[model samples]
Target: MAAMSKPYYVTTPIYYVNDKPHIGHAYTSLATDVLARWKRLEGQEVFFLTGTDEHGQKVEKAAQDAGMDPQSFTDRVSQSFRVLAERMGFSNDDFIRTTEPRHKAACQELWRRLADRGEIYLGAYEGWYAVRDEAFYGPDELIERDGVKYAPSGAPVAWVKEPSYFFRLSKWQDWLLRYYEDNRRFIAPESRRNEVISFIKGGLSDLSISRTSFRWGIPVPGDEAHVMYVWLDALTNYITAAGYPDESHPRWKFWPADVHFVGKDIIRFHTIYWPAFLEAAGLAPPKRVFAHGWWTNEGQKISKSLGNVIDPLALIDEYGLDPVRYFLLREVPFGNDGDFSRAALAGRTNGELADALGNLANRTLSLIQRNCEGKLPAPIENPHLMHDTTLHSGISDLREKVGKALEDQQFHSALEHIMFEVRYANSYITQMAPWALKKTDPVLMLQVLRLLHDALRVFGTVLWPFMPTTMDALLDQLGVPKDQRKLADLATPLPGGIPLPPPSPLFRKIELAA
Candidate 1:
């Protein structure tokens, strides 16, 4: 594919500050980071944004329970997310907090625009509200169990009645349906798209845009007594980071984000409410919203009450970072709920990382270093007919195969494609017996070694987005230049006789505790 001319913009949902950073948060951020890195590799200008959503009733209550002021509470919890991003090696261009001054200014300006467009009106909101979800559910959408009401998500709800401003969300229902129909890819995974369409077809009521009961959020423009609803305030972080409220800002070119990565629970908010607000504010909706499924630990629901919340940091500490990153994206198909068992993690670590890719790299490079005196082997002008054709074909087609899979956000398939080549190279090395050939046909041995070297270069460069640190080491061992690591470079051949650094193992074999 040709290099993209327009900036490729991507974002993770700004995580709510009421909870500590968890695997769910890490999963979304990592996926976004991988996409951002891939786009940069594709020679496209990219903007990746992630951060904390510090406004909401849940945050306010959490702050009070913790005996701290709202800003102090958010400042403390928000920093944890920043730490999570760094710990995960996310390549976000900016970390936007909802409480930032620029974000507040952006939210207020959006509100003013909506109000000026006559899409806002004063109203009293009386409904079942779940503080945990920061969402409202209609009577029909609520479930009653043991004489108590709960949102569909199982979060407890209480009756809330407050004088508030409303966004004319119902007015844009038809427009949104039309938009979804026109842009079929607006909501991803087909099932999610259908869900959003079914929910909109049911009916959209005007959404409560301001809350008088909560003092923890951004105050409404011209209405100090009321604060903008948390979801509206939170969603504005996307454009705020893209320099919203100032179109002339350089980053504004990245507006109308190429994609927004969100969890499945919030698909309604991103698909239904966010677009209506943006359209009313005379701004474009995001091009796509891909809501991924959740992760369950040990085949059980992961929750704080269950004491089964999989801490990403703990996983990283126990297993290496790249292995953890690989397992999460590789273990299950994207958009499907996955089980995080130690056995599954260990299996992929040992079987794929340590044995397949790592073993291949170790054997190929060790042979070159020992036999070729740590120099890159030269590729013969005319190679062995049978052994060379298939491996070269696989390596040559790798860039296109991986690129197409990644474009559709198929992380598993992309990694699988690379692993196919790895497995093939391993089998080829065994079949050709390059070691035995060293004494018989030294020329054929060098040719076989050179083939493996070229394959490793391609693998390292393409897999860098998924496993940056390990791939960086692999590329460095191959003496690949720092600047010459783009996707386009995969087609270029390296000159022979360049000295290579000593090979080191990319992954350690992990033994799961019984």
Candidate 2:
């Protein structure tokens, strides 16, 4: 495989640290992890980043509510997110926090650049602000419910007046429109791109870039009285992971991120404010930002008051890590909202993973172990059968097919392609009647077994990025070496007579709690 010259940088938005880690956090991180691993499989250098957004008024109040100082509160909550990364098997290259000294420096430096460019100025600000969202809302955007104002998100809003530093967002309105038009794929999923364009065309207002009310954030450069806004501080975590201020650090090679995976709720901040901020700082904006939709639990909106939050840790404990990972991307189309139900997860786990994939590997390998002296059979040399030829051709074309789907971030489509091969292999084995061939024509049985082995090898290798642990164990039984698991290595045929390890179940069928 010819590797690309430039490194691929992928990031999950730094999660707000106001609450415990939930399914939304896990979904974004897992999606980014899959992309990072796939790039690595294709022989490219990859930098994956995930972290906690540790500043803002919401966090300050949360800290006080928890009876802890802001720093201590952030330290504790941020560690949980880090632990979530570990528990989910996320291969993030770095975990950043807005509270980190390196990140603070980067944020302040960006602020200075914007200010020096005449993009920032001190001003008195007043507007309806949602503390829960850390966002400002125009009167038109707020809905009155029971004589009380709430943001469109249904979060209650309160009027606040304070001296603040403002960014000249209105100045870049026309320029941003042209940028979006020139970089057609900059904002993803088509739907989100249109949403951003419409919002910008509606007219831009100067953004509040600093807050004097909350002291729990990065202090403004040359002015300690105000701290930089949370979105600005949080967004800088991307470049901070790439060594922003110094720019000479080795990791800086990954600047100008390949893609940023963010929840749709935050698309405006990322696509609008983030790019504008980077441009004001004389830096290039990230190449692409993909905003994926939310997940509802059992057809009900997930909320704390509703008591229906889907805890990913609990799901992993109940099911399995890899199964949860597979179901997450495989169950829903990319960039579309999905409903999470115990029934749907269990059905996918049992139907797709266990019945379709796991069974294919188990029965095929068991036959080879039992009938072929527990050794890997040689590749089929003379396959006059059209079924044999067709299966070989399909597996040969499988990698590129899956790659195209992933390039579009169509994760479900990528998995569907893989599962198609699995289902085909299962059907091929059944029709070939490898068990009967063992009695009628033992020689033909071995050839069929070899074909099955090759299919399994390709399946295990391609699936490694999505389900590493399970695929690792599956590949272990196939006698594939640790270093020989890249997508390029698929071109090399698996050598026969390799001592195969004893077969074991890769995924177990599980029952969810009532």
Candidate 3:
């Protein structure tokens, strides 16, 4: 029997439309993009979805402040997110907007189903609410500072009491605990798992699922007087994108998403509230939810008040997309907090990209053009030589390790492994002194050139997912077929004596000013 095909379904948190796209949003999307691209390269059927969360009190207030209708405001701001995704090379298959009619229909259908199941009920809600966070807080979660009571934000919270509907979240606490205990990988990083377990152990509360105070969100089924809470409203986006509430819909085949890539701050909503919501509706929760860490700008938390929030578009415009993507994944471990700085970005691009990988390609291909008459020279087969054997064996090992790293979602490690091979190739060429060999023994020089070509071809194949355009250019210079550059071809050696083109410089060196 043939091996079964794997399915990969991934999502980034639907960004709230109250603010424009920022580095935080870009971070989540980029991480998901890398995963989706890698899985596709590995021959998995991938469904990647990302979109905007357009309905909330914060969005309403922001629209009002901007002197526009909520719909108009959201439309304009949401386009910024789409544009950013395209600019950053995101390959998401679907972009969902909560304001879309399809999503509204799905939300209404879900609400009715939960209501019919006796999971939703009317009640009064009075608590501290944060407009910025769109979250209701209990007394214990509040902090008092400077004679003002706040909901963990420095801004004072307004007291309001309103009739609302609630979800029986407390009734599902035992089930959630059992689910976590049985499925140890439900949350990520082990540390995040502990945090989530602690939060759930503190005791789950019946969640207020509807808000009578806000009229700017998805209206609750059978009750136009209230709208669904922002968390519930936002969490439904995953199923909405998969065409839920209409089981006959074609996209429903991808339901019960394989993975949801979210930020650590929102893990509770994804792990606790999202799973509970799915269970109440007789649906399966996503197979996994990986909550990744935050980023600070130059060692300080990004703050508009501090005037240091990083603009992703500006960074892309300044440094280019792949460099930004590479720096982000390479600079830090995936689940740990990282600091971003212009100096750090420049250093990695200059040292790893330009000097190491890029320069090696430039020199090797230029030598082929100048010394080998712009054609690949046939490699001399010498199984007895230790260096040749070692190079081949090392590349085969790298192929295996890179595949494992991608499977484990360790993109930084995968990229590091590829660059390590590049470094090895550069050193091999230097030690062999291929240029001198051309004068001493032309046949020996051809063998050395063949090794360089084979190394570059494999490097390009592994790198295609991370830096597509750059890798394509590198392969073109080596005269390798685009079709032959699939991920599975990493172990295959290029046929020698293929005509090559003069090497164009892959990356330019940058000088730091004194």
What are the per-model numbers of colliding residue pairs?
0, 0, 0
Model 2, residue 417: what's the lDDT? 92
Candidates in order, TM-scores: namely 0.98, 0.98, 0.95
lDDT of 3 by residue, 1-514 (tens): 2212656789999999988888989998988887888777666778999999999888999999999999999999999999999998999999999999998998999899999899998989887877787777778878887777887545568776889899999999999999998888788878888988998899998998888766899998778999899889899999998888888877787888887888988888999999999998899888888888889998898888999989999988888777788889899888889999888999999999999999888888888888988888775466347356666666667767888887666778999998888889888889888889888987778777787787888887777777777778999998888777666655456667788878887766555566
Q: Please list the residue runs of candidate 1 whose C-alpha ends up more than 4 Å from where it truly belongs after superposition.
A: 1-3, 380-387
lDDT rank order: 2, 1, 3
What is the Cα-based TM-score of model 1?
A: 0.98
The parts of candidate 3 lying over 4 Å away from their true place are 1-4, 152-156, 379-388
Give a tens-digit lDDT track for model 1, residues 276-310.
88988889999999999999999999989999999
Q: Give each model's whole-structure lDDT.
A: 0.91, 0.91, 0.85
Looking at candidate 3, what is the lDDT of residue 43? 62
| lDDT against true structure, model 3 | 0.85
TM-score of predicted structure 3: 0.95
Give the Å error, residue 494, model 1: 0.3
Report model 2's TM-score to 2 decimal places: 0.98
